[model samples]
Target chain A: MTKPLSPGATIGILGGGQLGRMLSVAASRLGLHVHIYEPAANPPASETADRITTAPYEDHDALTAFAKDCDVITYEFENIPTEALDLLEQHRPIRPCREALRISQDRLTEKGWLADLGLQVAPFADIKDAASLDTALERIGAPAILKTRRFGYDGKGQARINAPEDAADALASLNGAPAILEGFVSFTREISVIAARGLDGRVACFDPGENVHREGILRTTTVPATIPHSLATDAVLMASRILTALDYVGVMGVELFVTDTGLVVNEIAPRVHNSGHWTQNGCQIDQFEQHIRAVAGWPLGDGKRHSDVEMENLIGEDMDRLAQIAAEPGAALHLYGKAETRPGRKMGHVNRLR
Target chain B: MTKPLSPGATIGILGGGQLGRMLSVAASRLGLHVHIYEPAANPPASETADRITTAPYEDHDALTAFAKDCDVITYEFENIPTEALDLLEQHRPIRPCREALRISQDRLTEKGWLADLGLQVAPFADIKDAASLDTALERIGAPAILKTRRFGYDGKGQARINAPEDAADALASLNGAPAILEGFVSFTREISVIAARGLDGRVACFDPGENVHREGILRTTTVPATIPHSLATDAVLMASRILTALDYVGVMGVELFVTDTGLVVNEIAPRVHNSGHWTQNGCQIDQFEQHIRAVAGWPLGDGKRHSDVEMENLIGEDMDRLAQIAAEPGAALHLYGKAETRPGRKMGHVNRLR
Candidate 1:
């Protein structure tokens, strides 16, 4: 059996946003040190981390130095460049290995992997150009999403093709980048299963949380999602299958579309997720701490929820409600120490337990 | 209403140990920065804090600079010297005020304050010298505890005077420090109420927790303490009385002895107490966050416990159980990140929720 990482051991984190900020806080609680590597001058995680390497992901020298100091390298976001991972992996062990990220980084690859596991996904086809888009749209039909295969977040890098004539404009909009056309699925609601898998292959999943999005940014997630019991079970099972297929370690959030027929795989996050934020107030162990434990080779903690909870993200001007949230009797208000509240930026969040 | 402390506002913290570390974590969660002034290098709070000023409590220049940058000053431990408080308060707001610290720092003063509140306390008398010790021993009787009035913690600076002849020797051993001789209370169990008071004079208290001590150090604290409802109510009332009398703005813990007669106040901590650690798992807001909210001039959070919990401190060699503790299914482990764990040092703690 692998020895558990000691408290003073450093965990290297990529992408130092609020997720990294929270991960750093959770790591510190476990007596572990964190080294955050981000391009931003004032990444949220840097405030709480023991060390910060303010360098681009392409900087091999800095990445090497960071990797050499860290006992294990993990990431806050899945969009990290493959070259960065290859460089860091040379010096230290990286959890949720390169294979997992490779499969999860692109829409086509993620859907392909999910289909291979006998899980149902929204119908999709690869599109390279106008001609290919025409052919793909012929197969998937109208009202399909044309999304770039990589580097797209918060609804960026995507367009909708409503007709064959519109397909050409959509292809041109991506600037000739590789893209995929996905058939939209009519879903009753969207839900996600946030779970952790330990080195010993033990998986623990929190109950699925129903999610609502605003402009592709998560607005709120309410736990004990109002889905059929069988559908919830199916969502959790699909998540476990993905974890096992990737041989993944650490927490992975599996977002699913709960349709009238059944659950359809949406995408997988390779780290602690926004949907799981309710665990901070609802469960005994939160996703951040669970992710830390998984990478540390410690046993997985119980992910049982003691209360039904709702987590709301405070974006930009939403932070103005901090005082009102704090005044709420059963609300747990959490504000990240970001110096500025840019439009659409996640300034903080509040978890209310009932 | 007062303006909310902004993101760049600096919070001054005294006694930089694990409690201070957790407090800094909570403060950063609210976008408020912290500057920890501690005597030791690499104090636990320093790892995550924005700045660390390492200097002895007597360093006037360092204290002045620390106070000047902070919007408000608060402490993690109650044992800080009164002179240090006087110096810091000159430049910034000091929550819980100097009067609370003065009454809590000495046993005689604390007892006098409690008695003035019309509260029940063990029969006690002041002892100054051999003659005074002899007189107090006769008044308080044998099998009593003779404790130095100042600077005593975790069984230090005190001796058990089980017989009349031991009084003179015990008094001499303390080198004539002001002392308090008190008859022992035969109690069924020990319990403590951890509560917070906001600047608006609102009080919120968590359910009282039963505590067990070994060698004068807290061993474990279990919530939903096996006590009668009336007894727990009395404990909360006692804590409320103390907070009101002191005009306390931050969290304070009141330890009580449940005896045949009723509840007797054992002692009061002017800062967060170890027994309150269970709230991290059992409540929506832990004591650390509640303390930060109170000192930041924000409203106090809900201090209600959601489940029963047991918290055990990882003192010194007990840290060796990190693996087992981390593996415990429902346990939430918190390590202080201290570099060294000498005998009796509190390395971390674990909370198990039911």
Candidate 2:
């Protein structure tokens, strides 16, 4: 195992969105400084981070300089450009490794990797062109979802096909980008496990949280998920297996489908996830801090849930409810300092203890 | 009632020490920015604060610039120069108000104010010169403590008067500074209530934590103090009374001597106290966050402890035990990011949940 980072060491983060903002706060809590490298000026994380480089990822010199100052590099988003990662790795190590990103960035590759690990995943077929789309639709059948191969998030770059007649429009929705057709699985509910793997390959998983979504954006994640104990154990074990296989050394959020058969792997996020926000109030250590500890090569904290919690996202105009939320007892409100509140934009969240 | 500050507003903090560093982190958590003003270069708070002004309090231009950038000004230490406070109050509002500082800055004045508020405090006398010191010693009797009125902290500027033979030397040790002689009280244990008073005159108090001091410095603060339930209620009520009398607008740490008779007010810190560090892991809202909320004119959170916690201060060499402490299950380590660790300096603290 690599040596653990000292308290004063700097952790360089790639993206400076809400996840990076929360990660920076967590690093500061442990006496570590975070240097955020973001393209946009005055990013959300810039206010709290120790240093910020407002340069695009295309600027290798800036990336090199950022890496030179940091002991280790990690990221909040998974879609970092390959050239940028290549330049950053020359100066410092990146946690969760490039392989985890390689698999998670593509729907086909992620499903294939999970299937190769003997885990159940939705049936998927890669589509390169119109003919491939027809063949994939024929095999996957109707009521399937077609997603772009990369750079997709928060319901973007996705088109659902309800019947064979909708295949062409679904393929057109990709705009000639590579796509994957996934056969929809009949599931009772969606759940996620926020898990971590330490530098020593030690694994820890928080209790699964049941997820509820509106317009494809996550709305709430409640702990003590209705899943039975035996299934929870299986879910944790499956997540641990994925981490060990990738040699991952940071937190990952594994979204799963609870079907009549068993748990089905839906997707994996290489950094802290929205589904794990409740851990901030429900457990001793939160997912953001757990990710910081893992990337810093420190021992993983005990991921035991101490209380029942319900975390609700405050998207866009939902921030108008701040007055009511703040008035609620035992509710912890977290607001991202974004200047604009456009439609569908995540403004903040509230974690209420039960 | 004062208007609550918006999320993007800036909070100016004096004294860029650990308290300020933690306060900056708390402010950032609530989507607020902090501008730290300190004389020292690269003070601990600079690593977390949004902006840092490395100028002495004598730099009126720098102080004016800082106040211009902040919506409201608060402080981490009480020993700020009177001239600096006078200049700052002219530009922006200071939380806890100047009256609280005025009273707390002078030991004799603080004791008199407490006595006037119907709070029990140690018998004290103002000592202006050698003659007054002799007269105070005669009146207060032996085995009392002589302390400088303006700048004493952490047992500094203090001398013990065991008997009449030690009176002259003790008086000479003050270096001709104004002083206060306090009669010693035999007590069972030292306990402190961490309380907050919102802008609307509403108040909330966390449970009192028993404190243990070593060489006049706090070593440990354990919650669920061995005191009876009635005494705990008295401690909270007394702290609330003190806040009400001051018309305070932030968190205060009220230290008390728990005797067989009742609780005696020992001292009150106008800012977040070291004894309240346990709240970081014990409650939903911590002392730093509570202080920020109060100063921001937000509603006070439920200051309820959800878990039993023991916070041990990692002073100087105590940092060497971090490897063992980190390996301990459920121990949350919070380092202050101080570059140099000298004996008796507070480097960090650990909150262990039981």
Candidate 3:
């Protein structure tokens, strides 16, 4: 058996946003040091990490140094450039593996992978040019979402097409980037399952969390989601199946759309996700810590919730209510120490246990 | 109202152990930068801090630089020298105030302050030397404990005098350090009240936790501590009174011995204490966040427990049980990321909620 990483082992993290910041904290709590690799100066994770390499993702030399210093490498986001991953993988193991990244990075590839695994996903078709866009629009129709196959987040690089004429403009707006047209589904609510797969292939999943979004940004997630037990079971099973298929290690977030008939896979995050923030206050093992443990080659933690919980994101000016939220009984408030509170920026979050 | 500290404002942290580490995490969550001033390299807090100044406490130049960079200063321990406090006070605001540190550093002074505040304390006497030791022994009697006046923690720098003949040897062992002789109380249990005092004198105290000690090191603390509501109320009142008397800001821990008649003040830690670790899983706002809020000039958070909780320390080889603990239901494991786990070292802890 391969020996698991010890407390002093260094774990290299890619990306330096709030997710990376929380992951660094969790890794530090597990006696594993973190070295953050991000291009931005004063990235959130740098504040709590053992070291930071402020170099561009394409800097192979810096990536080589980061990989050399880390016992294992993990990314906080799925949109990591393939070349960066390829460079790091040559020197160190990357948890969740490149296959998981390849599948999750592209919308079309992700949907195709899920369909191949016998999982239901929204009807989708690739659009390469104006002609293909016309065909896709005819097939998928108006009111469908045309999204770039890669590097789309927080409602960026995606457009809603409401008319046949809007299709040409949407394609033009994307700057001729590769895109996918997805047929819209009438869903009752959105939910996500956060699960981890250990190096030993052990999979542990927390209960599904019902999600609410504002302008495509996650607003809140309530655990013990308002769904049938069988559906929740199916969601967890679906997440486990995906992880097993990819031979994944570390945490992965599986977003699902609750349809009238059943749950359909919406997307997959190859790293920790905002929807699982409730675990920080609601469950015994948070998604961050579970990811750290899994990447460190340790056994997965028990994903148990002691109380019903609701997590509300402190988006932009919503942070002004920190005092009021802090005063609420049984509310756990966590703020990302970002310097500026721009519009739609995720400043922090509060988790309330009921 | 005083304006809350801005995101770019630097927070000066004194002492650099795990408490400071956790406090840095909390502060960073709010976008505040941290500068750690510690005498040792590789301090736990240094791992995540924006900058670290490793110099002796009395080094004026280093201390001046640290104070100048910080908007406010707070400490993780009470053993800071008076000169260091004076130096920092001249440059920036120091939370918990200098009076709190003075009272807490010296056992004699702390007990005297408690008695002056009309708080219950064990019978005590000052022992200067061997001659005075005899007199103190006569007053406090056998089975009394002799502890140095300053710089003692985790049951160090202390010796028990069971008989008159043991007095001289105990006094000799101190090597002429100023000491206090206290009569041992037949206490049934030990508990600690962790409370935070805001700049405006607002006090928030968490539920008292019953602490279990192993070899004078805190092993476990269970919330909803098996105590009567009246006793718990008394503990909170005592903690509030101590904070108010000191005009304290930030979190303070009041260790108490539960007697048949009432509670007696055992010691006062003018910073976060291990007994408060349960807050990470049990309370709305943990001691670290409360401390950060107090120092940041923000309103104090509600210190309310959401669930019954138990915290167990991972000491030495006990860290090996981390995987087992992680797999246990309702267990939240926290490792300190320490490089070594020598005997008597606090490697990390785990919180279990019911």
On lDDT, the leading prediction is: 2
Report the poorest 10 consecutive residues by lDDT, candidate 1 chain A: A1-10
lDDT of 2 by residue, A160-183 (tens): 999989988988878999889999
- Give the docking tier of candidate 3: medium
TM-score of 2: 0.98
RMSD of each: 1.5, 1.2, 1.6
Query: Backbone clashes per model, in order?
Result: 0, 0, 5
Could you arrange the candidates by lDDT from highest to lowest?
2, 1, 3
lDDT for residue B35 in candidate 3, whole number 0-100: 93
Native contacts recovered, in order, as a fraction for each? 0.83, 0.57, 0.77
The segments of candidate 2 whose C-alpha lies over 4 angstroms from its true place after superposition are none
Candidate 1 structure quality by residue, lDDT tens digits, B1-354: 255576668889998898889999989987889899999989999888888899999999999999998899999887897788888887888987788888998899999889999999888998877887788777878899989898888788889998988877788788878889989989999999998999988999999999999998998999999999998998998899899988889999899999999999999999999999998888888898899888888888768788899999999889777777777888888889998888888888888876
lDDT of each: 0.89, 0.91, 0.88
Tens digits of per-residue lDDT for model 3, B248-310: 888999999999979999999989899999998887678888899899987787797878989
Return the lDDT, model 2, position B197. 95
Off by over 4 Å in 1: none
Cα error of candidate 1 at position A117, Å: 1.9
